[model samples]
Target: MASAPVIISAHLSIPDAELVERFVRASGAGGQNVNKVSTAVELRFDVAGSPSLPEPLRSRLLARRDRRMTGEGVLVIDAQRFRTQDRNRDDARERLAAFIQESLSVPKPRVATKPSYGAKLRRLDEKKGRAQIKRGRTTRNWE
Candidate 1:
């Protein structure tokens, strides 16, 4: 039987069909097993083509500066840290879920702020104190 859809958030759940998993040989430090078993998982999700993702959320995901995201809007995750296939699969799924969750919320607009008068005064005082210390180090006598 197929597993249930992966839940990312209360509102967002990714269907298993949208997630494509491929098993490949992992490189690095697993001795002979690395060459023998294809433990690494490559998870690919077509963010742009996915029907489940809303338009705004899709745009937000595409706006991210992650290298894993392709120009075509496909997000590729390679899981090779773990030696076991199951662990790597879970890791990839978790990462995909995390990425989706991040794009779910709209970021708050930043309010422009300036230093208060007291803060400015405190900064000026510190600068003056530093200047005074430097002035004291200068030799008074001309050699």
Candidate 2:
């Protein structure tokens, strides 16, 4: 089973336990029910105070240009798409899980490679063919 997100080693890590934070009603739609119910969830994650992640990963996580990340290195993901609080809360948790998974992924290193000999020859041949076609289209002023 997939684990939930966890905080470790100044970085965020995926954990079996859920780490989704929630809040009550605040601003925005809901009408009269908004005042009575706490349907909004404020998912809070500390990217700089986790033990599961290494220093480098933590720094990278904090440096991400996500609008959800706060100035204090805390990530606040708000989920209110659903009318019910529980669904919204679950959605927020899923979002957190997805983000952590993405952060944990190691990118493939790019290896520099020179153009193949056949490819270079093909390009030259195409250029030569184009030149010949253009030359044939010109008027024979010399004649």
Candidate 3:
């Protein structure tokens, strides 16, 4: 059996066996060629089933709201921008690499912050000024 292709990223590498690639005909303005040739590449990655991904990174990827991710934790990337099968294949691989790279970095946790006293005072003063302007615009009737 042939060894799986290895995809390298900044932090980790994934085997090509973890990825599933399917070729389909792209629907667009290409006259007859589009109908005859399967140029579009559909790359599928099993985020939940992949042994290559760490648990934390897998969870982070699954937490994403991208439409490309299926309910079953499979990430589907369609590469149809290029007409040629080879180019589309390369494009799909590139996109998969990018997604894996994105998962490598841990996001910084947000620190809880409170408004400073001076900031609160400034906000109140602005509101008071706005209220005064509105009050001054009121029409007064002199009998």
Each prediction's number of clashing residue pairs: 0, 9, 0
Model 1's TM-score against the true structure? 0.87
Give the CA lDDT, 0 to 100, for residue 2 in model 2. 46
lDDT of 2 by residue, 83-118 (tens): 897788778877876776676666688999999999
lDDT of 1 at 25: 100
Structural similarity to truth (TM-score) of each candidate: 0.87, 0.63, 0.90
Q: What tens-digit string does per-residue lDDT give for candidate 1 at 1-143?
A: 35568798888899999988999999999999999999999999999899999999999999999999999999999999999999999899999999889889999999999999999999999999999999999999897
What are the lDDT scores of the predictions, listed in order? 0.94, 0.74, 0.88
Least accurate 10 contiguous residues by lDDT in model 2: 1-10
Q: lDDT at 129 for candidate 2?
A: 100
Query: Which runs in model 2 stand beyond 4 Å of their true positions?
Result: 1-31, 34-36, 124-143
Q: List runs of model 1 lying over 4 Å from the truth.
A: 140-142
lDDT for each residue of candidate 3 in 14-79, tens digit (9 for 90 to 100): 777787889999989899999999999998989989998889999999998889999999999999
lDDT of 2 at 108: 84
- Tell me which of candidates 2 and 3 scores higher on TM-score: 3
RMSD of each: 1.9, 6.0, 2.2
Better of 1 and 2 by lDDT: 1
Which is superior by lDDT, 2 or 3? 3
